[model samples]
Target: MLPLLLVPPALSTAFALAPVRRPFAAAAAGWVVSLPALELPVHTGIGVAAVTAGALAVGPVTTADRVGTGLAALTCGGLAVVLARHRAAARVLDRAFEGFAGSGAVDTTTRTTARNRTPWPTVLLRPWPVRPRSIRARRGLVYGPDPRANRLDLYTPRDGGRPRGVLIHIHGGHFRAGGPSRESRAMLFDHALRGWASVSTTYHLSPTPEAGFPQHLVDIKRLIYWIRTEGPRHGIGADAPIVVAGSSAGAHIAMMTALTAGDPRFQPGFEEADTSLAGAIGLYGYYGRLGAETKDISDPVRHPADGAPPVAVIHGTDDMYTPVKGSRRLERHLRAGSSNPVFYAELPGAQHGFDAVQSPRYLAVVAAIARFTEPLAG
Candidate 1:
C-alpha cells in the first residue's frame, strides 16, 4: 500500500505544478517500485503487490503500515511551506504587473482577471483531443429512483440499429468521490461506435467516515439487476452479451458482481435471473485479501464460493498504485477455475487510470477493446 500513499501526494503535486507531468511522474514511480528488493523477496513481493494495487486503485504512492502516515504528514507540511513561498513570489509578480500597468501599457484589472481565469498550465498543456461525431453523439442517460443514491447514465450508438452488446461501466473515486457522470466518456463512445451499448451508473458512496465494504457492492448489484431487466427496452436485448467494466473501486464492484453471478446471496427482485455475465474488465482494481490468506476481501458481498467470471485484466507495468502482479495473480486464479478466459495486458510506462480516461494510452485501450469486441459484435 506504500504505492497508494505515494500516488495521491505525487498526483496532487503534479496537478498543482504541471498536469502534463503527471503521467511521467506516475510512470516513473511505478517503475521504481517494481524492482526486486535485495532481501526477503516474499515480503517485498507482498508489500509491492499491495502498494501497487493500492496505488492503482487509490492513486499515487502507498505505504505498508502506520509509520508511513507520520512521514506523509511531514511531506504535507513541507508542501505547505513550498506553497507559501510560491505565494510570496506570486505577490512580487503581481507588483511587477502593477508597475507595468502604471506606465499606461495595459489595463491592470482586465489583465489580472485574464491571468486569474487561465487554468493551471498543466491543464492547458495537455488538452484532451476533440472527439468526432461518431463518438460524441453516442452519449445518453437512464435514471431510477434511489432516495439514497445518484441516477445512471447509459451511452449507446446514436444510429437506430439494435446494439450488438452491452458494457456496464462503473466509475472509481475510492467509492467516495466520483459518480456516474464522471464515468469515462471515451469508453462509452468507443463501445457505442463498436456496436456496444455502455451503461455507466452511480452508487452510494461512503457518506460517513465509518461506511465501507458491503454498501458499495449492494448498490452495484441493484444497478446490475436494473440493467439486466431494463436494457431490452433500451435496444440492448436480454440475450445480448453483457460485460462489466470498472476502474479502481468500480473494478472491485465489477469483480464482485461477476463472482456473485447466479449465486442466491446476490439474487433478489428479478425472477429467473441468470446473472452470468459475458465477461468482466477490471482496470487497476484492488484484489487479494485484506489480511493474510484472505483471497476474498469482500466477505458476504463477494465470497470465494461464488463462481468467478471471464475476465480481461489491463494494468500499467509501472502502476505504483495497483501493481500489475495483482492482475497476474488474478489471471492465475481464474485460469485454475473451470476454463474461464482470462486475458491480461501490461502497458509499458503506463499508470493508473490509463485505459479509461482521455490520455494517449486511453485511446490505445479503446482501440484494443474495439478489436476485442469486433468478433462478438459480428
Candidate 2:
C-alpha cells in the first residue's frame, strides 16, 4: 500500500524529467503535468499530503509505507529549495543581463506590485489568470483580410491617457494552434496597468495551404502596419515605440520580425511601411524551421542582421518540447553581431508554458521584461 501510494508522485516526476518524442497523447500528458510541476509550492504540498497519509494509515504500517513516507519527505524538501529559487526570479533574471551592452540595472522592488500577489485560495486551486478590470480593452478589432485570424485585442490603462508605448504579444501553439485570448493575460494586464498599450493578436496557423513560412510573418507585418495606421484613433500614437513579444512559435515570429525589419520579402504589399521594432521578448521560443516545406529563411538565427534591437530570450532548463540549448545558441549568435543587450534567462526547474500562468516564476519574468523594455520606450 505504501509503494502504491508513491506511484503518482514517482510517475509525475518521471513525466517531468523524460523527453516526449512520439505518441502525441504521451506528449500531451507531459505538457499537462509540466504545468503543475512548475507550481513548486503546490507540488510540495502534495508530497506533504502523501506523507500525512502514510502517518495515518491503519492496520500494521508496513516497512514499504515508511519508505514511501521518507521518499515523499525528500521530495518535499527538494521542492522547497526550488520554490525559494523561483521566488528570487528577479535577481536570477538580472544576472542574465550582466555584461550585455546597454543593459541597465533592474529595480526588483518597484516592479513587483499587488497584481503579482497571488491569494492563497487562487494559488491552491490553480485557476486561469483573468484580465484585470483596471485595464480598458477593445476586443476583436480587425487588422487584416481574414476576419477571424486577423483580429487583435488592444489593452490600455483605464485612466484614459494615451499610451506612449505599444507592446504586441503573439500567442504560441507550434505555429499550428493558439489564440490571443488565453495565454499571457497576466503579463498583458500587468503592462497595461503600467500605462503601456498592449495588443494581443491572432495569426494564421500553419500546415494549411494558405498559411506557412512568410505568410504567417506577413500577417504579423500587417498587424504592425495596422498599428501604425489605425492605432492613433485608439489612443496609441502613430510613432510610438513598439516592442514585440511571443511564446513558443510566436516567439520565433517575434524574433524574425525584429531581425528582418524593412525586408521587402516579408512585407510584399506594404514594402514602404516602417516596421522597425524597439526590442523583442521571446518566451520558450523555437528558433528552428517548422516543417519540411518551410525553408531556411524561416530560421531566426540564420538572419542575424546588423542593427538588431535588444532581445530577451527566456526558457526553462527542464522544457520537454523546446530545449534550452536553442536559446543558448540564439544568445551567442545575437551577442556576436548586435551591440544591444541580449538578456537570456534560463529558469531552473521550470517547464514549457510556465508563463501561461501567473506563478512566482512568471512574476519575476514580468518584472525583468519591465526592466528590459521600459527603458527603450519613450
By lDDT, who's the top model here? Answer: 2
RMSD, one per candidate, in order: 19.0, 3.8
Instruction: Give the Cα lDDT of each candidate.
Output: 0.56, 0.77
- Judge candidate 2 at residue 9 and give its lDDT: 60
Residue range 1-378, candidate 2, lDDT tens digits: 666665566455545545364576777777676445445456555766755584656667778777877767655655565566566665667667555434353333443344345355644555457777888889999999999889889999989898868999999887778888677777788789888999998898877422567888898988999999998899888999899999988898999999999889999889999999998999998887665566568777888657678889999877777878888888888989888777888887777887766667876787778877777766
Per-residue accuracy of model 1 over 30-135 as CA lDDT, tens digit each: 3343322211122333443455445446654434544455444443553443334322322333343353344332234344433433233322233243444653
Q: What global local distance difference test value does model 1 have?
A: 0.56
Q: What's the residue-level lDDT of 47 in candidate 2?
A: 61
Q: Candidate 1, which ten residues in sequence have the lowest lDDT sum? A: 34-43
Could you estimate the TM-score for every candidate? Answer: 0.60, 0.85
Off by over 4 Å in 1: 1-150, 181-183, 207-210, 289-307
Clashes (N, CA, C under 3 Å) per candidate: 25, 0
Runs of candidate 2 exceeding 4 Å displacement: 1-6, 17-28, 43-71, 100-127, 208-211, 291-294
